[model samples]
Target chain A: MDASKIKQGIHKSKGGLIRSFVTIENGAIKDIDVSGDFFLFPEEAFFKIIKELKGIPAKRGKIQEIIEKTYEKENIQSPGTEPCDFTESIMKALEDT
Target chain B: MNRWRFIDFGLVDIRDMMAMDEAILKGDEGNTFFFWTPKKSIILGYFQKAEVELNLANCKEYTITRRISGGGIAFSDDLGRQINYGVVGTIDNDLFPLDIIGSYKQICGVLIDTLIHYGLNAAFRPINDVVVTPYLNTGTKGARKISGNAQTRWEGKLLQNGTLLLDFDIEEMLRISNIPREKFLDKKIASIREGLTWLDRELGEQRDMEEVKGIMKRKFEERFNVRLKTGKLSEKETALTNSLLPKYYSPEWVFR
Candidate 1:
């Protein structure tokens, strides 16, 4: 199970549905893609979080911390969508059971 | 009454349409309302990946593009089958609510009134859609969406663009975009066909686009208590939009 495999998660955020597909290897994120019909202001800022997410332990606290920090640093405004929404989706992908 | 400029940028390339929207947001365009149609394209939400949301094999005939604002994926055509409109103003406009959902309610209220004036039973679904439900006898219970709207804020300004589905080709829409079963399942619908409605289908007749546009113009003025004077893009906006065009057409942007 530790061998890298793809998993998916979907969350209904305040903004809209957010879906994440993660490639996990050894209980850490090898690759992840967050996609959806949600709003994120200054969207160019998202790449920063994506770049930082790699290799982070696949846990709720650890995943959410990364997104929350990015939301603050980038002044992100994702109406109807929150940092935790992204966290929930990523975590679901990590712990899909 | 506060008067806002109304500009119609006749059918143009999708990239130009997006560039123009950004230019108006960044430049000193004052308060303006714009009506534009993109030459056939499937526009992706800001956060969506084309490969995830669209069927690339079916997209060869259409230009795949992304909008500066965030929202669901949608299709557009220059053949007068859809109506696209945007309101650009400093978020401080007296009637524009400062909060996101509040703003949608305010603007979509006008759209709801407009559609109702045409005898369509349009309603605003929270978050961001104008929808209409079929009569009970029709065997469809839930509201089906007819319009898609999204907003983006910058500095002190906000630009919101929404499209009203005066008409649509469901076959083409499904062909271009993958409507996952999970999307319509919550609504108790078996397919995207059941989850969507349009002006033509709801009314059983086509409303002349030009006539509908005229009525929509009046609805905005009436709803906001503002006069929308027919106008053209400002010199500053035109120049900036032209300058920004190259990036939109570049592969890095379209494919990025």
Candidate 2:
């Protein structure tokens, strides 16, 4: 039985740090946990953002699009962070194979 | 003219301090600022993983607590050396602008002005820190961090909390924090020493805590153009704090 395993990556943003741990199985995201020293309004939206990314194919642009869309849809105000920062973190994690 | 409640809770336990901040932010208050020096402890940000960010063995030597706000981990003590403050207020355009970045800048600006008025040349470092750039032989480009801040918003109220390192033990800070990875411990510690500073390190001596508080209070009042009445927590707030204490002490909350 094949199961997802965790891969982690950390990125230093302009003012803080972004750490992402992702579980991937069969080339799709199984689970993800994003934690850091950064501030994000609608703080609860963070967990939801991670959940939304689950089951999505591990493609850079697609994952980036979802991150940007979820933040906008949830009205998350993450100071000193742009969507690219998160995308870069996810991309790094996916490459951790 | 906005009225603010100023409470000076000296030598508090970290858990109780966190609970008090939660309660005040929940209450129907205009704005409140709490000043306190906590017993030696390491406070982890809300979203941080204690296992990843803290040196648990070192934490056992003191105390470990987690805050509702999200930011980096911090070391705080009650020896009248460091001053910790928590501000609770609504998200308003006039004072705490509706935008997050603006609010941080506004609050950091107040803190920078306050530190300068207190006879230290302080400046606001982007996102969430207050720092001082000292004249040195090596000529580091950026300033050294003297203060760190974090915030959490519940409903419409925002709880912005931070620490002012007056007289800190950099050695102890490095010992307890998960900084200076094993491979580069020596180099990292040296770099950290260069990048961070304390008030006493800049001023050359430990100053009176009360005098420091007075300066901070007066500066806050002046910057915000608000008068703060010295006060204590309301009965309801006290009760809420007591109830919330257990949550802060729980393993689930701390580890989460």
Candidate 3:
């Protein structure tokens, strides 16, 4: 399998049902979508958070930093999920299933 | 003493109802319970993709709308089979705890208690849902969902909304949503419905909407130790709803 090829995958959180879908190309997230029963405040932040991930490296540290910063700056409150949950989901999507 | 206002706006369209919720949360500072019955509509969550989760043709057949609240797909109809409940209030330390999940748990507890009062055992199924217990003596799955809930914090206030399914049109639901029957999506909807039980199904008979509302109001008062004063939408809230209705009914917002 080519590591840099564009790919799509889904990952449900380790501890919860929060799920994320990611489209990756050359180890970078090209697009993503999230949906679940989990609650995220400032409801508009749901789309904004996903937008912030575009073009970001798929590395865990980089993804984590971006998610945390976005949530903090936007005052987004997500119950049943943390910033690392999304970071890990994207990383898992990058991995071969 | 804790106090909450209970406002019943009767039947309304999805756009007006959703706008009213936001307006109350924006313009009011105290706790409020808003009630309304919506015409058949598929309410999508803020982050949900309409193309992937819903059947566009069916949505068109039976009007669809997107809500700003964060939650999974839910169906409601004005056939008196469901009651839409919305709670709007400031994020006050006095009314509820400051934690997000905690507040969800507390509100769901009230809902569960309401069901229990009706002799139908129910339980809170984390994040935001209430499920009724075993379908024993019947040939269906156990612990089915009777309620779906979601919330959002906007404009320094919290708006929590939920639907209590007194009855549901399963056929219509299957027709509208893209819930599959043999894959992951299948598993998702399967677990959701396997134990799904409605009020009429659980009670072995159809129950009137007023009866359900009366019991629910009493239950909330008992659980929260608050008085619920019957109220109506004020001029400010009504005006805001008018201004917000166009956006809610607009294609840009619904498809966004």
**What is the per-residue lDDT of model 1 for residues A1-97, given as tens digits with 9 covering 90 to 100?**
2334678888777678788889877888888888889888787888888888999988889989999998999988777788998998887787775
Models ranked on DockQ: 1, 2, 3
- lDDT string for model 1 (B1-256, tens) is 7888889987877888888989989989688888987788888888888877888898988877778888888797545588899988788646777777888888888789988898766777778888886555243357888989988888888889999888888888888886666666556778988778888888899878888888888999998889988888878889999999887777676566
Off by over 4 Å in 3: A1-7, A14-26, A72-75, A91-97, B1-3, B77-79, B135-141, B180-191
- Which CAPRI tier for candidate 3? acceptable
Off by over 4 Å in 2: A1-4, B77-80, B135-140, B180-190
> What lDDT is reached at residue B94 by model 1?
63
Candidate 3, residues A1-97: lDDT per residue as tens digits?
A: 2335534344444223445567676878877776554567776676788888999987889889999999999987776678877776677667745
Query: For residues A1-97, what per-residue lDDT tens digits would candidate 2 score against the true structure?
Result: 1334778777766746777788887889888877677777777788878888999998888898899899989988778777788878788788887
The segments of candidate 1 whose C-alpha lies over 4 angstroms from its true place after superposition are A1-5, A95-97, B77-79, B134-141
> Which residue pairs show backbone clashes in model 3?
B144-B195, B144-B196
Candidate 3 residue-wise lDDT, B49-107, digit = tens = 67767888877755667787767777875465888888876766655557776777777
DockQ of 1: 0.64
| Steric overlap count per candidate | 3, 0, 2
| lDDT by residue (tens digit), candidate 2, B108-215 | 776677678767667766778887765452323457888899988888778899888888777777777665232123223346767788888888887787888888
Q: Return the candidate ranking by lDDT, descending.
A: 1, 2, 3
TM-score rank, highest first? 1, 2, 3
Please give the TM-score for the first chain of candidate 2.
0.89
